[model samples]
Target: MGKADPKESYALGTAGRGLDPRAERSRAAALAAASDLLIENGWAGVTHASVAARSGVGRTTLYRHWPEAAMLIQQLLAELFQVEPVERTGELRADLIGELRSFLRVLHNPKSERALRVIIDQAPLDPRYAEVLSACSCKGTDGLREIVDEAKARGGLPKELDTDVAIDHLLGPLVFRRLISGQEFPDQYVPELVDSFLEPLTP
Candidate 1:
């Protein structure tokens, strides 16, 4: 039920250091157990007691580290959503296609997909989750921004175009296709969609 090789950086960062290896294992086990709990039971199912029972890491330890569901969720997200920055190939169409392909790969993983669903489900009702979600989002935003900036500098896109709107135009469809449609076409759909966007833009 847990992700294989749970990331210790997120745990170490959130809880602070100075723990023995055994203590680190206990913390990582708790986080992994909580992640499994989130996937299996969603937000409502995860509690300090539940995580303690699942991980056998003790309720007091869960309370000491996570303190609340939001904090625990924050730690989980920090580990799960490791969005990498996009590398530009100097071609707008190619860069965009690469971006979508990369994003789709992340979404293709069932564990990551479930984590996103949980965050999206909670962000509306909880400000803490919203904050964490925003942090994750900014990483994506930066990548798109870079692609757009590079495209504009190369005269691939109009100089006067609103970058924010452009980012939406570029990323919105792939996101919509995956999250809203609940459909995935990571291989065949990427290029067709990229071409569809660029056809109107090209002079």
Candidate 2:
């Protein structure tokens, strides 16, 4: 990946004015185009021009909103995951399970899963994809850290482990099962995962 830093402020259109209805529609169309392009031609195809051509959004408008292919990639990810920053409830086990399910919903979606897979596989060659991947990963990591930190502040997670370690213990199996084992985790997966991680740390 060239590390093509769209270096995008990622705040092109809305420095001050939030997107109007018309602008929002145009951005949505472009994003839809990006999604289709990603699935059809992979990450390499989702340029501002390609999205404009597919979405019929003017280049000026596309540029005004998504200045680079990386922006399109980021937006496509936001669309696919719809994985909003799930509000924290301060309940460690429940919070962890909720976060996993938020991600699981995306994995269960065939198109979203395929798009994610494509981005990860192509990241080495497409710097744009890697940047988006790093950005998205950071967001998730932050959320997980928040959950663990809150639990620790409440005097939970008494064991000698940091938030990141706890997260690895909680998510490692899921990753291994999904990516390495080529398997779909069953209903028991999340609860069992939470229990295993929490049990060792609990007094």
- Evaluate candidate 2 by giving its C-alpha RMSD to the native, one decimal: 5.3
Give the runs in model 1 whose Cα sits over 4 Å from its true position. Answer: 1-20
Candidate that scores best on lDDT: 1
**Tens digit of lDDT per residue, candidate 1, span 1-203?**
22222344334234535566787788889889988998788878888888988999988877766668667877786567766666778778888888877777667666666777777888998876787678767756777788877787889988887789877876787778889987757566879887887787779
Off by over 4 Å in 2: 1-25, 47-53, 58-71, 85-90, 110-115
Clashing pairs in 2: 1-124, 3-127
On a 0 to 100 scale, what is the lDDT of residue 110 in model 2?
61
Q: What would the TM-score be for candidate 1 when compared with the true structure? A: 0.84
- Candidate 2 at residue 2, lDDT? 21
CA lDDT, every model vs. true structure: 0.75, 0.70
Q: Per-residue error at 15 for model 1, in Å?
A: 4.3
